[model samples]
Target: MRFPFFKQERRVEERPRDFRVISPRIIDILTHLKVQAEKLKRTYHRLLARDKELFEACVRAEQELDRDRATIYANEIAQLRKMSRTILKSQISLEKVIL
Candidate 1:
């Protein structure tokens, strides 16, 4: 899920040219991606903790077994990709400055 996002960010970061000199928008995008990636990382950590808590309760015979369809997570993953697609597809063309 987060793997593809991470991979795309890596590929973009690995570009042969340094756009820092020519495009601030690219830098901004990179920064935004880094922040979002961190957020996803934290979300994973929190979800893991939730799973662990559920497992502990289940082991103690206090938690009932309730399962959700896999599609729930799948849809969330798809939505994330859709958001990234929209973000990346946006263009910021430079305007000519009059002398």
Candidate 2:
């Protein structure tokens, strides 16, 4: 069924890709990745120092927590001792007389 309505077989032109330098966006992305890689490599070499700092920080935090815990325990013990002393003082003993 040929109606000859639409144009038959349009001719398309094939163009060759122009070889040019790298685009600025691509260059910037590559440079950024390169810098990031260098930073990662440097950090990898400093793992021991990083670990030591983390350990020292954890130790300091644990010591502070222990000091706070000790203070709380001491306060509770002092309160209990005061209550015991008060109870002992308030107790009355009846005198016993036997003939």
Candidate 3:
């Protein structure tokens, strides 16, 4: 004797796979990507503003003949520039994904 639980049954119907079913997920992913891109843009702009401020301070220090202070400010500006480059690259990549 065979058990009923041991028998395999085939599905009588299968739902059609179409764009309507997948559009929502695609939209959600694009929205997330856009948000991330905006964040990166904001961060990049903020870095630029800060870098400008540091550059001014460094110039002031140099005019005052303060080598150490100017050096420190210059180093910070360099680091900010590096961060900005990284953020810009990420933003570009996100834009490509969204497209």
Candidate 4:
């Protein structure tokens, strides 16, 4: 449909697409991730040590028939395992960031 009162205009030029460089922000994010990864690693190691002690204590509790104590240690071990998995995931993400 054409309107008698409207004018038809033609574009004479095309605008180029704008490109942006974001290396600095990326570097800052990677640096922060590196620090977080290190902290996660430290936490992982500490958890492992604590888990080992918990296992040993659980074993002693079992031998003594201390059901409640054994159950408590078992729960802690499960929590430690869950935390370890998160640390591993963070490490993998850190590797991806480096690449």
Candidate 5:
């Protein structure tokens, strides 16, 4: 004989899932993340441009045989490179989250 408990269980299992309730929030979050990644990329490019300018200055200082000025520019370039590396890591991490 058929059982009432089994009929109720089958009905519950057959109900369709509605993703419409959850998709918008996910889309918004991903869109925000993509924007952040783009911003980081722009910042990285700016840093690279600055680094190039500094390197040129440093080389000029060295050619002039000016020890003090060349040393200062070299130190500044090192700091800028370190900062650029950190920004790149952060951008990669955000992209991973978006994926």
Candidate 6:
């Protein structure tokens, strides 16, 4: 009285997943990432040192520029004083000649 369509089919057995195959590959990737991270950290520190050195150089250059500007201004002032003295001596001689 039962039909074949009413009977349950047998289920296929699934194989257990093997993590050993994937675990080593993941470990290798993690190890590579760690090595790369260390290298990047070293590079960043080197860059920082270079930046500090450049800043110090800029400070030295600025100091030199200030000294040069002061020297130029002092020379110009001396020249102006000499010119003023010459004019006063000429004026005094002219007054004596007229009198």
Among the numbered candidates, top TM-score falls to: 3
**Pairs that clash in candidate 3:** none
Model 3 misplaced regions, further than 4 Å: 1-22
Instruction: Give per-model TM-scores.
Output: 0.43, 0.31, 0.77, 0.68, 0.77, 0.45
TM-score of predicted structure 2: 0.31
CA lDDT for candidate 6: 0.58
lDDT of 2 by residue, 1-57 (tens): 656896687798987766476689877876766665555445544543554554555
Off by over 4 Å in 6: 1-22, 66-99
C-alpha lDDT score of every prediction, in listed order: 0.49, 0.52, 0.92, 0.87, 0.93, 0.58
Query: Per-residue lDDT for 41-95 in model 3, tens only?
Result: 9999999999999999999999999999999999999999999999999999888
Which whole-number lDDT from 0 to 100 does residue 2 have in model 3?
A: 64
Shift in Å, residue 99, candidate 3: 1.1
lDDT of 5 by residue, 1-99 (tens): 778677554454565777566687898998999999999999999999999999999999999999899999999999999999999999999999988
Off by over 4 Å in 5: 1-22
Error of 1 at 25 (Å): 0.4
Writing each residue's lDDT as its tens digit, candidate 1 over 1-99 gives 567556454444555765447587766776776666556556655655555554554444433333343344445545655554444333211111100
Which pairs in model 6 have colliding backbones? none
For residues 51-93, write the lDDT of model 6, one tens digit per residue: 4554555556557786665555555545545554554565455
Worst 10 residues of 5 by lDDT: 7-16
Query: How many clashes in each candidate?
Result: 0, 0, 0, 0, 0, 0
lDDT of 2: 0.52
Rank ordering of all candidates by TM-score, starting from the highest: 3, 5, 4, 6, 1, 2
* Candidate 4 error regions (>4 Å): 1-25
Q: What's model 4's lDDT at 38? A: 86
> Between which residue pairs do clashes occur in model 5?
none
Candidate 2's clash total is: 0
TM-score of model 1 (CA atoms): 0.43
Task: Pick the lDDT winner.
Answer: 5
RMSD of 5: 5.2
Residue 17's lDDT within candidate 2 is 65
